[model samples]
Target: MTIALRDAREQLRDRFLFWATLALVVASTASLVTGAIALHSDAATYAAARDQLLALGKDAAAIAAPEFYPLKLMRGMIEQVEIMGAVIALVAGYRAAAAERGRQTLALILTRPLPHWAYRLAKIIGGMGLAAVSLGIVIIATAILLPVVSGIGLGTDDALRLALTWAAGVFYLTVLFTLGFGLSLWARSPASGLIAAFALWILVVLVAPQIGDTMDPDNQVAGGVFAQLSVPKAEQDRIKAGFAGYETFRNGIEVASVTKHFERFTFAILGIKDTYTGAPVDKVLAEKRGDLLFLFLFSLGLGGLVLLRPINPDRLTKES
Candidate 1:
């Protein structure tokens, strides 16, 4: 508790965390505004359709009003988090490890009455708490800006879904934080961790997803290649079924990315994915079980490494 609070205050003051949080807020506000415009358009269309049906004398009971999930307005916010959120966590992790090494703070902490592993464990817990704070501010902004921009109040169901997505975001950031922190500790030089972290980020967060998307025969063209060519869904599936090996390889690349799983889980929860739109929360969670497992295992693995990796102060002191 002591360490976690101190981590929050200290990281917020650091230039990296301060600037990252500010930039994320600015970008997410814009995404939510754009989402609002889309929601209002959908609402207007629903109203027009309802009126048209009434004029046709359709039974009132037959004309069920469309369900509007305003939480769909946060798709852009999710993507922004997918990108910038990793940076925030990575920087926090790097600074936590690198700064302490430069100051020999870990060595000094080890000399205290506390057990050898206590400070390390506390620092990691502190790091996670720090990530939660950074993402919490964005989620709060999302709650505020969503209704104001779209003129549609978020329903209790949608609010609960949004909260679920927020929790997933915090977990996703925790994984990245541990990865960065662990790398910093393991690297011989302080700079290698930051470089390697960004390299993996570029690969897993950015490149892998693109490769998967572009590899899909349906996604090659604007507005979807299959749609543009007037391809039927059944035919598309049948056609791709013959190339199962190719599909498997492409999916394998995407599955390696923690960001992809985070996006998939959150998208299904928030109805950003078309198939999941209007799906019940329980059903969506059940369907996305694989993604949830990946996220959980990713966090558990990274956290285990950070806690268990051999820590040598001699290596830190030697890294001129």
Candidate 2:
């Protein structure tokens, strides 16, 4: 417990970790601000268009009120985190193992009275604790900002959704952290560990998603690729249907990319997906059960692997 606490405090004081976390918060907050402005602008435009139409004796029934789902505004923040926040996890993970080796502290720490398994467990818990704290900041900021931005207080459902997203974000970041920690454990130096970690990050978060998007044109862009194509819905649907075995291919890609799984689950929970909007929260969750489950297993399995790996100071030092 002491080791865990000490390690967490050390991580908290790390300048790189602190600044990375701050950047994450700033990016997410910016997304919230931008989303708020966009929402207000949209509302204003709809009102103006409606007034003009009504004054011209157009049918009032034709105008629809844009349903302001406050939590949906967090879409940008979630994506930003998936992209930029992964780097934070990589840094934390790399530091967890690499810093100890670089400073030659691992040899002394290993010489302590503590059992090897216990020491390793403590470090893993400490790393996860730091990740939770960083994600907690995101959740708190989102909670505080949501009500102010949308002019609507969080309802029971909205609060639940936010909670779920927070949970997902924690799990997502922890997975990356564990991956980084594992890479550091295997590498000879901090630089090698960081490089390996970022390489994995690029492959998982960037390459996989881009390949998936390329394979399925409809999923290529934000707000659906068809939205920007000026294509009719029927034509889009027809084009989407024209592809053979695309659904299976797309699902396979999404399953491979942790980012996709996290994004899909969070988007469903927050009603960011068009099909999920106005749907019952329970139904959306039910639909996304596979994604949520896969993400949990993937994270926990990798974390467990890290926990089980032997932390030999001699091997780490020799490699360095």
All models, RMSD in angstroms: 3.1, 4.3
lDDT digits (tens) for residues 96-169 of candidate 1: 88877787776787667876456667778888787778888998898888888777787778877877887788
Off by over 4 Å in 2: 41-66, 220-246, 318-320
Give one digit per residue, the lDDT tens place, for model 2 in 1-320. 98789998899789988888888888888889877767767767887988998999998669876777777888888988898888888878887877777777777878888777677677778877887888889778877876676555678888788788888888888889888878887666667878988988899899987787777766658767778878898987788677757777876875799999999999989888878987887898889988888778898888778767777565676434
Taken over the whole model, the C-alpha lDDT of each candidate is 0.82, 0.81
Model 1 accuracy (lDDT, Cα): 0.82
Q: TM-score of model 1 relative to the true fold?
A: 0.88
Clashes of each: 0, 0
